[model samples]
Target chain A: DAGVTQSPTHLIKTRGQQVTLRCSPKSGHDTVSWYQQALGQGPQFIFQYYEEEERQRGNFPDRFSGHQFPNYSSELNVNALLLGDSALYLCASSLNGGVYGYTFGSGTRLTVV
Target chain B: GQQVMQIPQYQHVQEGEDFTTYCNSSTTLSNIQWYKQRPGGHPVFLIQLVKSGEVKKQKRLTFQFGEAKKNSSLHITATQTTDVGTYFCAGPYLSSNTGKLIFGQGTTLQVKP
Candidate 1:
C-alpha cells in the first residue's frame, strides 16, 4: 500500500505571497498533522486535523492554517509568507490520535525569497 | 510551553561503533516516539514508548523511556552507513492529548566506513 504522500516536492514564494501545500494520508488512516522543519533542525508541530475539523494547533500564528478533506487528505496554507517561513513542511498520518508511530511524507520544501 | 531537547546535536562514528542520543522533555509526557530521516528524505517511524521505564528493541536499535516519562534515549549498536541520519524524538504537550507533538531538535548521526 502507498504511504503518506505530499505534493510539490519543492516550491518558491516571494514575501507577502501565499502558498498551499497538499498531503494524502496513508490508506486506512484518518488523522493528519503538519510540521515545519528548518535546516538542521527537527520537525515542529504546526497543527492537526480530524473529522474535517482542526483539533489542535501549535504555537504558530494565524498566518498558518490547514484543512482536512473527507477522504483524509490535507492542505496546509501559509499566508503572508516571510523569509522565516522558508522550511520543509512535513505531513504525517496516523490511525487515531497518533499514539502510535506516525507515517510521514517526504515533505514540501518551501523557499521564501 | 513544552519542549523536547536532544543532546550532541551531531555525532560522527566509525562503522561497527556504537552511538546514542538522549532526549529530554521540559514537561511530563504521555508517550515518546522516535523517527529517522535520511539525507534529503522524510522522517520514518522508528518506535514508540508509552509506559514509564519502558524499553523496546529493534534489531540493533534500542529505545528507552525514563521512569518519570520526561526523558528518552535511542541507542544503536554497531552503527552502519545506513544509520547516518537525523533522529528525532517527539511527545505530546498533554499526557492525555495525542493530537499535538513537541519534537526535539534532533540528533544528526554520521557513520564513516
Candidate 2:
C-alpha cells in the first residue's frame, strides 16, 4: 500500500506570490490534515479536512487555506507569501478521526524568496 | 490555546547511553501520539497512548502517559546512531474530533557512535 504522497518536494516562491501544495492520502484513509514546520520547530497544525469540508483549523490567518477533493486528496494554498512562510509543509492522513494509525508524507519544502 | 512543550531541545549521547524526552500539555488530552523525524526526512508515526497512566514498550523504546493525560514521555534504552533524530509528542485539541494535532517543540536526539 502506498503511504501519503506530496507533490513538488521542493518549491521556491517570491514575496506577494501564492503557492499551492498537493497531497494524496494513504489508501483506505479518508481524513487529511496539513501542518507547517518552521526551522528548528515542531509541526504546527494548519487545518483538517473530512468529507470534503474543513473540520478544524488552527490559529493561522486567512492567508492560509485548504481544499479536500472527493478522493481524499488535499491542497494547501498560501497567498501573499512572505519570507517567513518558508518552511516544510507536511501532510498526514488516517482513517476516520485518526484515533490511531496516522501516516505522514515526506512534506514539501517551501522556500519564500 | 492548547500548547505542548518539550524539554531539552537538543541531546547528544554516546552510542550506548540512554535518552529520554518529556512532553507536557497545557490541557488534558484524550490521547497522545509520538513521531520521529530523521535528518532530511518526514515525521513517522511511532506510537500512541490513550489511557491515563498507560505504558507501552516497543523493543528498546518505552512510552508512558501521565496519570492526568496531560503529559507523556519517550525513553530509549541503549541508543544507537540510528536513533539520531527529532522526537515529537502530539495530542489533539480539546473537543476536536478532526485529528488536528498540537505538537510539542520536539526533542532532537544526537547519538554518537
| TM-score to native of every candidate shown | 0.97, 0.97
DockQ values of all predictions:
0.86, 0.78
For A2-95, candidate 1 gives per-residue lDDT tens digits of 2999999999999999999999999999999999999988888899999999999988999999999999999999999999999999999998
lDDT of model 1, residue B84: 93
- Among all windows of 10 consecutive residues in model 1 chain B, the one with the lowest summed lDDT is B92-101
Top of the candidates by DockQ: 1
* lDDT of residue B65 for candidate 2: 98
Residue runs of model 1 more than 4 Å from their true location after superposition: none
Clashes of each: 0, 0
Which regions of candidate 2 fall more than 4 Å away from where they truly are? Answer: B95-97
DockQ, computed on Cα atoms, for candidate 1: 0.86
Give the lowest summed-lDDT range of ten residues in model 1 chain A: A1-10
Please, what are the lDDT tens digits per residue for candidate 1 over residues B1-65? 67899998999999999999999999998899998999999899899899999999999999999
